[model samples]
Target chain A: MIKEFIRKRSIHVCLVCTGGCNGCDIEVAALLSQRYDLEQYGIYYHNNPRESDALLVTGTVAKQWQEKLVEFYNKVPEPKAVVAIGACALSGGIFQQESDKVGAPVSDVIPVDAEVPGCPPRPAEIAIAVLKYVPPTLASYRRKI
Target chain B: MSSVIWYLYEFARKTWIDRFLNAKTDPEIAEAPSRFRDFPEVQKDLCISCGACVFSCPSQGAIKLVRDEERENIFPVINKSSCIRCGFCVEVCPTEPKTLKTGENYLIMEEYRILPQEKVYIADEYLCIRCKKCLEACKIGAINFKDNVISIDQSKCVSCGDCINACPVKGAIKETYIINIDEQKEIINTLIKSLEGTINLEVERIRKLPDHDPDKIIKLEYPLADYLQKARNIIPNDEMIIKTVEKVTDRLKMNIITWDDEKCNQCRLCVNECPTGAIKYDEKIGKVERDPEKCLRCTICYQTCPFGVPGLYVARFLLKNNVILITLKPSQIPIRG
Candidate 1:
C-alpha cells in the first residue's frame, strides 16, 4: 500500500536523444528549466529507465545506433510510456535521401506510445506530451465515497 | 540585254556553290527533308546528385550520364530516338533547381513519379551491446531492446525510428515493431490521463482567477493563497506543499503563503491564523465554517482541519502506493459560518 502511495505521488521520466540534429533535444530540455517548470506537475526526469514511468525519445534513427536503441527500450520497466518527437523520428526527412547508410524509421524500431511531429517541436508541446503520461489523481475511490 | 545576262549568270553561280557545299554532307541527310525535333535539356549545376531522377527513369537505355568536360559533375545525355518521351527522369529529382527543361517542339510534362525503394539498414543480432545508445538517438522512440534482443514495435512505430543507424553493433537491432497491442494501449492511456490532469488544473486555476485585470487579486489567486496557508498549519514540514504554493503564486503573479497541515494534530490552525476572526467551529456539524465574503478564501482554516482537504471542491482523489494525487474542481459551494 505504501509503495502504491509513493508511485501515485511522483512521475519519473527518462529522456533519450537519438541520431538526428539537436533541435528537439533543446526544446525538450527546456521543459525542465524554470520557464516551463515541469516539476510543478510532479514530473521528474530519471537517468535510469528502471525508475522511469515514461520515456521521451528524440532524433532520427541513424544506421550506427540501432543496437543501442533496442537495449534502451528493453531497460524501461513494464507499463512504461514512450513518445516520439519530430519529423525525423516519424519519417527519414532529409537524411533519408542524403546518406548512403540505411537508417530505420522510429515506428519500425520500437513501440512508441505517442508521436509529436515537427522538424523540432516547440517546448510547450514537449511539456504537454510529458504531462499526458501522469495519472489524473492520487485519491482512491473509497476516499471519494 | 547586258544587265539581264549579268543577273542570270550571278544566280547560276550561287546555285552551283550551294550544290557543291551540300554534296559534302552525309547521303542520308542530303536525301531526307529536315524536321524540328524536341529534346530534354538537363541543368547540371542544380543537380545535388541525389540520384532520385536517375533511379526513377523508366526507359531502359534512354538516358546516360556523361562527364561534362568543363564542369565537375556528370550531365545526362539523351539519345533522341531512345527517349520515349515518358519524362520519368524530370519528375523525381529532389533538387528543384536542377529540373530538366524541354524547348520549342518539346512540351513540358509534369507528373508524379515514385522513386524506387531504398534498402533500410537492419541491425545484425550478434554485435549488440544492449547499451540502448541508438534508442536515445531516435526521436520517435521506436527502438525496443527486449529480453536482450532488439526489435521494433510495428504498430506505434513509423519505421523512421532509425536508432539502428547509431548502433555500435552491426545488426543488434532490426527495422520492425515487435511490441503487442495491450502494452501500447497502456502507455497511450497513461499519457492521455496525465496530460488531461495537468491541463485541467492549469485551466481551472486560471478560470477561477479574475480575468486579466492586472491590479486586484483575482478570485482564484486569493482563494488558493488562503488554501495554502491553511494546508501549511497541518503539515508544517511538508516541503512539497510549500513549493507548490510558491510556484503557483509566482505563476499567477500574486503574493501567497505555504501552509503545512501535517503538524496540526487536530488543533485548529485557522482560529489562530485568520486575520478577520471569520472562522467559527460548529460542534454539531463536526466541521468549521466561515462567512463567505468575510473569509477572504485565505485558507488559514485549512491548516487546522486535521484532514488534508483544501478549502475547495474535491474533484477526484486517487491513492496509489503511499502517494496522493488530488484534482480540485472549482465550485461556488458556500462556506456557512
Candidate 2:
C-alpha cells in the first residue's frame, strides 16, 4: 500500500549531462520556473540517482562518460526510466565530426525509453516526455517484479 | 496607524489572495510564436512530384516520395522521428503558394525567394542526332557534353527556348509545362479524336468509289491543319502540340505508304526526285531497290511515279470494348504535291 501510494503521488528525476552544450539543460530547468512549474504534476528534480525514479539524460556521451554513464545508470533504482533529450543525446550532433575523440550517442552507452529530439527541445516537450513515457515504464517494471 | 491599517486591508482582500492560490501557468502547452517553424504540412494535389522536397531535406529518411492510398498520385511523406523541423523542405518547394508550409513567416529570408516557373525544358536524346546546336545557342552555357551525350544543366538553364529554336529536328528540344496536366491530356485526346474523324470521313467516300481498291495508291491533305487553332487555346505551345500529334499518329499507325516492286518501270524518275535517296536502280539485277530504313515516308516517290509504284493509305482507329481496331484504306483522290 505504501509503495502504491509513493508511485501514484510522486516521481523523482535525475538530470545527467554526458558531454554537450548546456542548451537542453536550460530548457529542462525552465520546467521548474513559474511559466511551466512541473512540480505541480507531482514530479521532483533531484540530482541523487539512488532515489530517483527516472533519468533525464542530455548531451552526446563523450569517451570519458561511457564508463561513468554505465555506473550512473546502475546506481538508479530498478523502476527507473531514461529519457534522452536533444539531438546530441539521440545522435551526436555537430560533435560527430570528432567521433573518435568525443561524440557518442547516449543510447550507445545505456538503454533509452523515450527521446525528445530537437537541437534543444522546448521545455513542454521535455515535461511531456517525462510524464508520458516514465509512468508506463515504471508500471511495467513493477509488473515484472 | 493609518499605514498599518491600509496594509492589513490589502492583505485581507479575497481577490488578491485567490490570485496566489491559483496555478501560475495554463494547464496546456503554451502556443509557439508565429515565426517558429515546426513540422511542415504537405498539400498533396499541388505537388508536381519534382522531388525538390526530397532533395533539399538534410536529414536522411526524414522525407520521401510515396504513392497515395489510391496509388494514383505520388507525394512526399515526412517521418516525424527523424525530422528535426528544420523547414528546408518548405523553403525549396518550387510550386506557387508552396506545396509544403510550416508557419506564417516560414520563408525566413527574402534572399531565398524561389521563382515559380510553369514551363521546364528538356532534351530528347533519340531525336538529338548528336548535334551540338543547343550547346552553342545557350547563352549561359547550360547545355554541355557529359559522358559523350549532351545533357541540360537544369540549374543554369533559364527556359529561354533559344535552344529549342536553334534545334533543326522537330521534337529534339521539348518545353514541358508543369501545370494543367489533366487539361493537357484532354487536349491530346481531343486532337487524336479530331484526326481520326477527318481521316474516317475520307475513308467513307473511298469505299463508294467504282475503282476503289483497298490497296490503291492515293493522296490526302494534312489531317490536323483545321484543328490546330482549336488545340492552341488550351495548349499555347504550337510546337508541343504538333509533337504530340506526330507521336500519336505514329503510335496509332494512322499513315502508311507501300512500295510495289513489280510496278517500277525503271524510268529512274523516283530515284532523281527522292530527297532522302531511299530508292536506287541496281545495274546488276536491272531492277530498282527501295530501303525502308532510309525512307522518310515523305511521299515524294508516290507523286513522281506515274505507274503508281508507291501506294499511300490512311488508317482510321475504332476503340471497341477496350480493344483498338485499325482499318486501312486508300485515299479517293491524289493529293497535289
Candidate 3:
C-alpha cells in the first residue's frame, strides 16, 4: 500500500555524466522512454538541477571534468540526494587503470546517499535506489499498489 | 453517424465498464505474464537481414537462420519454444538504438545460457603464414602458430568478438553455430579436459606463493634482485634497508602502464627508467617485456610511455600485485583489460 502511494508522488531527478563512455547515460534515458515507462511511478528526469530532488551521477569523474562534477554537485539544493550509478562512478572502473587521475568516488567529493554498482547497473536497480529516499508513508503506499 | 456513435458506445462499455468489473477474474489479467523493465523486444524495421544474431545466439537453436525468399536475404527467426529469453541477441546485436526493445513491465526469467563452448578454428597447415596474427587476435591463447600452422585447442573461444574484430584479413577467422547437440557435447568435453589440466597448473603456481602478507614479496625477478642488492649495498643499516623496501614497494602499488605492439615505437625509455628494472626490452621482437616478478607496480612507466593510449585496448591491473602483460602480435593484442 505504501509503495503505491510513493509511486504517486512525483520525483524529479537530474542525471549527470562525469567522464564515462555514455553507456550508462544511454541506458538511463532508455528507462525513462516508452519501454521502461518510468512515468507510471511519477519518477521523472529533469534537465535542471534546481528543480530536481535528487541527482543520478554516472561514469568516472575524470580529472579534466572534476571541477564540473564538483560544480554540479554543489548546485543541487539541500536535502538533495546523490546516487552514484555504475562501477566507474563508484570505483573508477576500467578508466582507473588507464589514467593516473584517481577518480574521486562520489562519496569522496560529495555525500552519496546510495550507490548502484555494475559495469552499467540494470535500470531496475536504479529504480530501487531512488525508492530509498521516498517518504515512509508514500513508500508503503507504493508497496500496497 | 448513428452507427459510429453505437460503435463508440459499445467499445467504451466493453473496455471501460467490462474491464473494471472483470478485473479480478479476467483471463487476460490473470494469465498475463509478469513484465520487468529493460526486457528486450525485436524491432522488425531495423533488423538488417544479417544472420550474425542467429549464429551468435547462445540459446541452442533458439534463433534459426531463415532465408526470406521474397527479400532475397537471410534473417533470424526466433523460435519461442527454446527461447530461454536471456537477450543475448539483444546485447550482442551491433545495431544502434538496438533492434530489441525491453519494457519495464516485462519480466522474463533471467537465465544465463551457458553457450556450447565454441570450437577454436585452426588455420590449415598449408595456408598459415606463421605471422602470429591469429595468436594476437585470440584472447584465450587458443591459437598458436609456433609450428608454422595455426593450431587451435578448439576450447577457449568465448565468442567475445575479440578475434573477429582483430582479424586483419577477411576469412582468416570465422564463427559458425553448431546445430547438432552431440557434436557440441563431444567438443565441449574435450575442451573441458584440457582446461582442467591448465587449472591444475595454475593452482600449483598459486599454492607456492607466500601467505596473504601485504609486505611479503610474492614474486621476484632479475631487476628486482638487482635493485634489492643495490639497496642493500647502498644502505648497510638495517632500518635504512627496511625503509628502502617500504618506499619501493609503496611506489610499486600505483603502476598502470600498458602497451600495444601495434602502437609502440619500441623505445626503451620505460625499460631504462624503471626503478626496479622490471621492464626488459626484447629488441629482436621489437617489444618491451615486463618481468612481473621484478615490477614494483609503480605506474611511472605507464605515464612515461608515449604509446600508452587509454581505451579498451590497454592492459589494466586486475589486482594490486597482478598485472595483465599485453605483448604485440602481428595483429592486435588479445588481452581484454
Q: Please give the CA lDDT of all the candidate structures.
A: 0.53, 0.72, 0.54
Judge candidate 2 against the unseen true structure and give its global Cα lDDT, from 0 to 1.
0.72
Tens digits of per-residue lDDT, candidate 3, A56-142, equal 888777777677777887887644678888767776654544344756466777777777765566666677677665433233332
List per-candidate RMSD values in Å. 34.6, 23.6, 22.3
> TM-scores across all candidates?
0.28, 0.45, 0.36
Regions of model 2 farther than 4 Å from truth: A91-109, A143-145, B1-24, B27-29, B67-72, B106-337
Q: What does candidate 2 score on TM?
A: 0.45
* Interface RMSD over true interface Cα atoms for each candidate: 25.3, 12.5, 12.5
**Model 2, range B1-337, lDDT digits (tens) per residue?**
9999988888777667777677454645666667777788998898876667875766545676655646456577886655668888888898998999897663244332134666677787788887798888889997988876777777676778899999998777777766677767877778666655655566545444333365653344443555677888886877666655655554564545566677678989787656445688999999888997666555557756888767666665543332334566664434333
Docking class of 2: incorrect
Candidate 3 per-residue lDDT, tens place, B1-337, comes to: 9999999999999889997776442233223234432334566656664445654554343555444546644345665423434566766676786676544323222423344743334345554445676678776786665545565555455666576566665445544443444533443333333323333344334333332233432232212333334444543444433333332333222222233455557777676555555677776877777775554333446546665521111111111222222211111212222
Q: What DockQ, on C-alphas, does every prediction get?
A: 0.01, 0.07, 0.03
State the TM-score of the second chain for every model.
0.21, 0.36, 0.24
- Top TM-score prediction, candidate number: 2
Instruction: Give the Å shift of residue B237 in candidate 1.
Output: 86
Instruction: Compute fnat per model.
Output: 0.00, 0.12, 0.00
**Looking at model 1 chain B, which ten-residue stretch has the lowest summed lDDT?**
B249-258
lDDT tens digits by residue: candidate 1, A40-114: 657888878888977777766777667777888889765566788766666654354434353535777887767
Listed per model, the TM-scores of chain A against the true chain A are 0.80, 0.91, 0.80
